[model samples]
Target: MSKTPKYFIVEAGALPEIFLKVAEAKRMLETGEVDTVHLATKRAGISRSAFYKYKDAVRPFNDMLQGRIVTFQILLKDEPGVLSSVLNIFARSGGNILTINQAIPANGCAAVTIGAETSGLEVSMEELLSRALSVEGVVRCEILAG
Candidate 1:
């Protein structure tokens, strides 16, 4: 018998490095020390391109009620922001990312495996499918739910 998948929620522009700084900036801003991106980036030693690359792609983790999770194996084109775009869908769909594994391209495409919890998805699986399919460089999206 197969199990269901868990999901998480993330921003559309968030990336790994940017995600860390954004979290830090949120805390710093709370202390009223810095409220601008310039200050935050300066303090964090992150470039603006890196910040903008993943500004909206960050998200908090979430686990499914059924305690199930899905592993999405994606084939992405070799280009900038392609991986981020793919992650954005999962983030926007409330896919709590547990881990992301990628490999070097073999045929102008890279394989990425993302483990996420599908606990509190705002949209249906069909919608998620549509979104993933709509990405610019996504060659394939294989959902491995078990």
Candidate 2:
């Protein structure tokens, strides 16, 4: 049986530069910045072989989750100011909050569901999630829907 592929959220700084180049080339092609993969790779400063090697494996987070209503399920520690700190992450990242529903604290944790419009995000979805996960009270944060 074929195992499902695993996914990871890696910081751009931690990734090889070639991956960024491939993403840039893909974006250039999609946006009409370049007419072909050859030109895209050339402009992005990566070899065509390098682009082809990683193209299918890398997609920009902004492209994957941009311009849509994204719903996030966040698990937070039941503590004062935890929710506010999480919401501030969204605000600072340009996520426009559309709705939020919080379940009562249970087992010293709270589950919060947030729906936000992501068209205006100043950072990538990956960056936004990383920031959320970095918060002191955030136990988990993930996209529930989009």
Candidate 3:
């Protein structure tokens, strides 16, 4: 039977140059900087055989969080344009809204749950929430689940 795969978070300086080159080639492919693996490997200064050998094994740390969908729950005052303002914060920061659900207004407040693909967020989650809370009529904001 094959052994289970184990992962390690090693520093870049300690890894071999080949591993780094493989990762760089992957990045170039992902970012559309190179149209083909041949070009990517050429630009990364590694042979195609070397890249193919280790391509599946190397990746950048931030890549692990790239496709994550975060759910945010915000409490806002029930007023015209209040919800739009909160959404504007996400729009400005490159957070893509996948889903939004709002409970009926009660006691002059509304509860909103927003699911956003935050991979492209220009600001950290905490900073995004802080900006949301700063908007007028927003009462409470927190990450419910991601």
Best prediction by lDDT = 2
Q: What is the Cα-based TM-score of model 3?
A: 0.56
User: Residue by residue across 75-135, what tens digits does model 1's lDDT show?
Assistant: 9998999999888888888777899999999889999888877766677555776799789
Candidate 3 has which clashing residue pairs, if any? none
Ranking by lDDT: 2, 3, 1
Per-candidate TM equals: 0.53, 0.70, 0.56
Better of 2 and 3 by TM-score: 2
lDDT of 3 by residue, 5-87 (tens): 89877878999999999999998999899889999999989999999999988977546545698888999999999999999
| Model 1: CA > 4 A from native | 1-67
Higher-TM-score candidate among 1 and 3?
Answer: 3
* Deviation in Å, model 2, residue 18 alpha carbon: 10
List per-prediction Cα lDDT, in the order shown: 0.71, 0.92, 0.89
Clashing pairs in 2: none
Whose lDDT is higher: candidate 2's or candidate 3's?
Answer: 2
lDDT of 1 at 55: 52
Give one digit per residue, the lDDT tens place, for model 2 in 6-116.
777687788999999998899899989889999999999999999989999997666767999999999999999999999999999999999999999999999999999
